[model samples]
Target chain A: MAVTAEEILATYEELSEIEAQFDDVETDIIRHQYNLSKDLYVKREKIVSKIEHFWPLVFEQAPMDIDEFIQPSDSQIILGALKSIDVKRFEIDTPVEGGDPRSVSIRFEFNENEYFENKVLEKKFWWRHGKDGFVGYVSEPVDIKWKAGKDLTNGLLSLAKAAWEEEQTASKKEGKEKKELTPKQKELKEKLDAEAATGAESFFCFFGFIGERVSAEENIEALKKEAEDRKKRQAGEKVEDDDEEMKEDEDDEDWEDEEDLDIFPQGDTIAMAIADDLWPNALKYFTQAQESDDLSDDEDDEDEEGDEEEEDGDKPSKKHKACAHGCKH
Target chain B: MAVTAEEILATYEELSEIEAQFDDVETDIIRHQYNLSKDLYVKREKIVSKIEHFWPLVFEQAPMDIDEFIQPSDSQIILGALKSIDVKRFEIDTPVEGGDPRSVSIRFEFNENEYFENKVLEKKFWWRHGKDGFVGYVSEPVDIKWKAGKDLTNGLLSLAKAAWEEEQTASKKEGKEKKELTPKQKELKEKLDAEAATGAESFFCFFGFIGERVSAEENIEALKKEAEDRKKRQAGEKVEDDDEEMKEDEDDEDWEDEEDLDIFPQGDTIAMAIADDLWPNALKYFTQAQESDDLSDDEDDEDEEGDEEEEDGDKPSKKHKACAHGCKH
Candidate 1:
């Protein structure tokens, strides 16, 4: 049977759900790959479209939306990788636009102005605060300034809103299915819950040696500033200028988008980037001079400058004579 | 009890004696970690360093030297990872630097041209002879190119030399102390060796698929150019020409090290880029305000805004909402 574009669209949504929220990492990934490969070659071209249009982008950041809170994916805990790159983001030069769920970036103002620098780190929503008398972690924050701009990543928001709607609708439709409990049991449950919720100590403290957590916001700000300055100086060669141009171009693109844009093909940036990174070493084989000719001449080619290495039982060469005035070669 | 660097180094040299090669996926990175952790911070720090420095500088458009070969690590594959970054180069960079004898980076290449562009598709090194088939892999070029820049990294070549000596000496000592084998057994061993050598086609091909296998150099280069251009275009603003005065003014700070310009940091550029990529989400967390706080201020603070999330239940109005409609209270 012909797999329609509609089925691919449905599959995309289903696969995204399985990938993002489905709790089992391996299972979700397997399901995602299976779906991807099933129509792998067939709808391959459309994935790029989906990614390009994944705007009014949805970002995963901050405390769960109330619905997500009540029934969070168990897998969400493991995915709390504190550090993750939206690998796709590196590949696309799309302007930073606004209006998406979890699109916040953090800006920490140091309590001590010594750490202050005009810097911004654009990223997803996150939180960190000190709790205990002993300082440890002053959590990093996620800023949401992007939304104030042209508000383009709304597609991501609508997706979140739709999920929210489903959560709300699900809550409404399938509720009242709870069993009636005795007063004593309810009392015990509430007490347990209260104790859990009201636990005095906070875990977010930036713990380490003493004074490490003190004015951690300042320290973090200082580090962030340092990091930010370092980047601007490095990419400063062209980034800021490019950033403005990119944003303007995006605004122009948005003018043409007229609110609705297709997303399937664009989502395949992940696929495209993968293809790009893997083909090089593969190419060496195709590009090599016939080994019968080349490999024969180069069997012991490594014995010259300074790097001598060992392979299994064979010695490639003592070619790198710099390792202590070597003459044994 | 003393753990001086020299003693620790000597102990590490001895440890490689029992370290037989494995042809399976790593069930334990901890083991490699434990073995290579003589310079724990050094090793871990080097992973990022290897990625930042040697990758772009040496391997990006370099030719294969054919003399370098890496013993596979526990997970000897980074087959389709050319999309964002290639962990495949792990072996060459690690060995080239000789940071850790136990651990090796998976082999990866930039297609001599293609780097991170496609979503990983096929990563196998093959040659259509138009006559004879299947040219073997020669990672020597990557190693040679990688080594060419070793002086830029600290003591990495020295460490590699140390490892080579340790391995060579250990192998020699073992050979000297070995027991004699019977003629039939010797013949069997010889046969096995030939078979193992003969059996390497699949192994190398597998390596081609897993590690060295990659896309065309042109494809990756084009993709990178496209990605970089797109990135610039997405983020590009019209560059205002810098006034020579302002450029000179910024240059006025003239640090003493600037005089010693030859030793300026190379890895710092990619390092900053990496940190740039990592900083966004961290920034967001620091910026978002607590939605629960606002809800509590509006009504009773004690209810905790329906923390249970009422899974499969009615949507409670009091439920906590985070980052909604521009982080509205």
Candidate 2:
């Protein structure tokens, strides 16, 4: 299920194997690009709020005796420096030439396509460090950068792990035919695995958030409305293409055997049957959802700007709508 | 921030630690319980849907063998299960009876004090494995059984390795701060650990419907609300009691401060300041809002029954309403 912490780590491990596709990375160094899409600003406040609300539960502050490095892993999709890195226990401060140095520099390399493209975050280290017990500057905010491909791999992995946890808790009735993965499922998972191998953001959210969680969100009707238009994903009970082909061949035969002589109308019968066909593929609605989220990723940036903005520095719109169509980063 | 999967895992770990303190041996076992929660179900569906949607992706099958665990660990999570039992594939339907099969049991063991106990779950030969399929109905449904002071060592630890994934993920983020458990959280965690050790269930929802994927008939919001409340499980945060000596010291400071603010207006100012102190204890109001979500949980259930007797589950007046003194559960 990859729901546990181990699976998340494993997912990241998978993402690490596919780092060549998403972001820019060079050798072992992460090019730490502030890849905030234009719309990310709109959701910045909410993202930050959600993160701040939960982060304290994970990282507690301790007095640090040495300088430390803290940054989101390549698999992480952090919004701001606060959420992206942990500076609570770090004695990381430096004297600014003329201003407070809450800034860090980054260099990006995208699969030998682009290498060491440098970027710096300014006024980032603006928090009082309870650990170091000093109000100073972070001369060098540790640069934890990654190639885009790796970012996607890791993000996808983290999402996959999240999905796994969701599944474990769902409580599938035991002995209820633990369904095997179809070839399409295998490929989706394989692609997920590939993304994980490269340390990039995972598209598995389509699986996690959409596949499992959406049913509970009360948006079924709205989502169902999009089902007809959303067919990028597949139907259920399909193990492989051969099975699907065989099933298609037998569909007509099965159709003829079931009350064909003026007893019941074929339209209603077909509708019910289509609904049955849609049950397994119901989650595929998330694929289009992902695309829609992608589209809104760009649209939301404009809206996110309406809510709040990262006061530190404006990042180029790299904000991928977690769910939207026309989503180009 | 326990915002990421790692953070969430750490939170659960901390909760487990808090659950520990009830009874020494009982709580210890809970620390070993397995918690797959949600990922597997979503993945299984996601993979299947992807397979169905993109039947083209499935070029060929693995040549269906009843015994073969094809792609045993395609996403690595399945591999984790295989690794735990020390086999890539093992037959469950071979039908062994009365071996005390362990399913994914999430137990929370408690002492007479009524505080939280331990929670244990794992993957092993649970009672859910029927001869044919789900309807075979060989055993009783999973029950949250707890014996007085029972040692849950083996049961809790059965799937400890799988839970380790969750634990490690949480530890990764939390280790950077507060230095893991403060010996107190660990004490609390044992209560949950004990449940894992002692109690066993028939069938494991092993990563079932942790979250709602999608529902054509039901509202997504309703499903989401269900998932959220069910997941809530009402695990309380561990609170550290003040030392008696420390309490005395605080009393002494109060008296000293009174002496310092001898003037009337100055004393009033001091009193206001004292009242306004939002530092340590004051922060609790804003931190992790202990809002009652039980109300939201039942909102859907009532709607479903349309005023049926199922509303008995929504007994907020009896349990969670605080009885006007804020003593709600």
Candidate 3:
């Protein structure tokens, strides 16, 4: 009963069909759940907003997926002046065809403090089906207007902002034009990179997150047509120029080089954690805040020096201390 | 903006209502997805069953959640005799009210083997909403009548099965009568406990999994009534016998001692990992078998001795080797 390569290939074909069906079922579930939970989430927002310091406390006790990214500086701003947070499936209610109901926008509201001047920051992620048959969130950079010398990312956000502007400009050009960094931009990027190598990033760097470094509209139609042709080929229909397709796949792999330059490489994961877990379960985290406070208090003596340890041991000691202080705000 | 204890309680009340709504939405989504995917899964099963050694390969490449539980001895039985595996939402289509749609029955079809007499071992887990507001799967033991000297559980399953039978008899008796273990049974339990303390238990013990050691019907009505009364109290309606309710809660903590005696303490988690992840994604795992085979080949030299290490290092080495040999079968 030795399975030949042909048999394995056939099995793969059958399984691919099943996988497609599973994907469709998942997509339907996401859309249906989005529509069903929309109003309830709206109501949830209204209720949670009534409680003071709710958003800050939720962030303080957020799961490691998000908590790992928040720097001590980020916590200072969050605990001090953070007002509220909201997450919305921005495309769910839209009538536009091809708009994904799973796409979300996370909005953070803050009070005036010794930080950025903006009262609101909203970051949107588009649920995308990639040409390579991979599906995930794709996002563009959302610029944060930082006050002079108040940049929490230590110039990384500013450098990334400049690069994003260049990308936007390049995207507007006739072809996929690559831009050369200005000398000043290069200097800033080098300094930021060196600094980033030594320390954890400020969570505010999430705003400057331009995931994948790929344009949303770039060759999308061509990619869709390619995918369609490949699906047809798999169904036993004769397809031409598979060698050319192979070459294109090789070209796609070159995107890895570009991805290496992303300032916040895990932006998509962090965003998902916030949108899916932190936001939806905010109330649970908010309630657990008191329990965590008590737990942290027990370790307070050890935690002061514990903050200087490696990332795994650096469990946001200062934030909890600041939170303990802010508990009386 | 200091949050008072009363304010925190108020916040908890508001959030609990939102959580209930979220739960309902989740239930609806689960039911809807189950119905939608039923036919597709049936079609998938037909296609997969036609392939030889599919189940064996899938078991070899399962996720760590499942792979960790499988002993080398268990793998021998699985890879040699396991023909197919099926998982169904058994109660999803039931017309009866209060039948949870999430309840699942996992069936493992086997060919004639030295391990047990049963041709098909099916374990059903009920989706239960506990009195403590925790929702999870609850299951009773499914007896596997093993041949003498061929038992992989090292006599643990036999002891547990006897205990389960006694408990079932006790459950049928009047006034929650407690069953006293026979002298032999007590001696066997102590031997098995000593053996388990020194080494990892076999995956075959899963068949003896009597999760939570509580009857499914026990106190369910009373618990529901208590929950309702608590809700009424939360909504500012006075409920009688508050002191009695507190005493009942205190008494419930006694169940922890009962839970400690479970032979397979992680049975619920293992069952969920299989049903939710391994079974649904069997084809993915089957395809991944060849890839893991290649990866494990690089480590095969060290893995021979690695098998004798602690549980973390004691991954199923012989299983993969057996799979590699069976690849040509």
Between prediction 1 and prediction 3, the one with superior DockQ is 3
Model 1 error, position A135 (Å): 33
Model 3: residues with Cα > 4 Å off, grouped in runs = A2-7, A95-97, A147-150, A171-193, A218-223, A226-256, A290-329, B2-10, B95-97, B132-134, B172-189, B219-256, B283-329
Candidate 3 lDDT tens digits, A1-329 = 68787666666555655766776797788889888888888888787777777788888877886888888888999999999887788787664444566678988899998888899999888766544333556777677778988887777777777766765564456243334554444655676669867888778878877654434553365346545755874676643433445346646343224554567867878888887778766755665575456546765655543333222222211111112112210
DockQ of each: 0.02, 0.01, 0.23
Candidate order by TM-score, decreasing, is 3, 1, 2
Candidates in order, TM-scores: namely 0.17, 0.16, 0.79
Which consecutive 10 residues in model 2 chain A have the weakest lDDT in total?
A60-69
In TM-score terms, which candidate is top? 3
lDDT of 3 by residue, B1-329 (tens): 67787665555555555666776897799889889989998988887887878899988877776788888989999999999888888788664334567778899999999888989999887766444333556677777878988888777777777766765565455343334554444655676669867787888778767654334553365346646855874687644433345446645343223554567866877788888778876755664565455546665554543433222221211111112112311
Q: Please list, in the order the candidates appear, how each scores on TM-score for chain B only.
A: 0.17, 0.14, 0.79
TM-score, A chain, model 3? 0.79
lDDT of 2 by residue, B114-155 (tens): 211324322122222111111000111122232454322223
Q: Which regions in candidate 2 have their CA more than 4 angstroms from the true location?
A: A1-147, A152-184, A191-208, A212-329, B1-329
Give residue B137's error in model 2 in angstroms: 45
- Rank candidates, DockQ, best first: 3, 1, 2
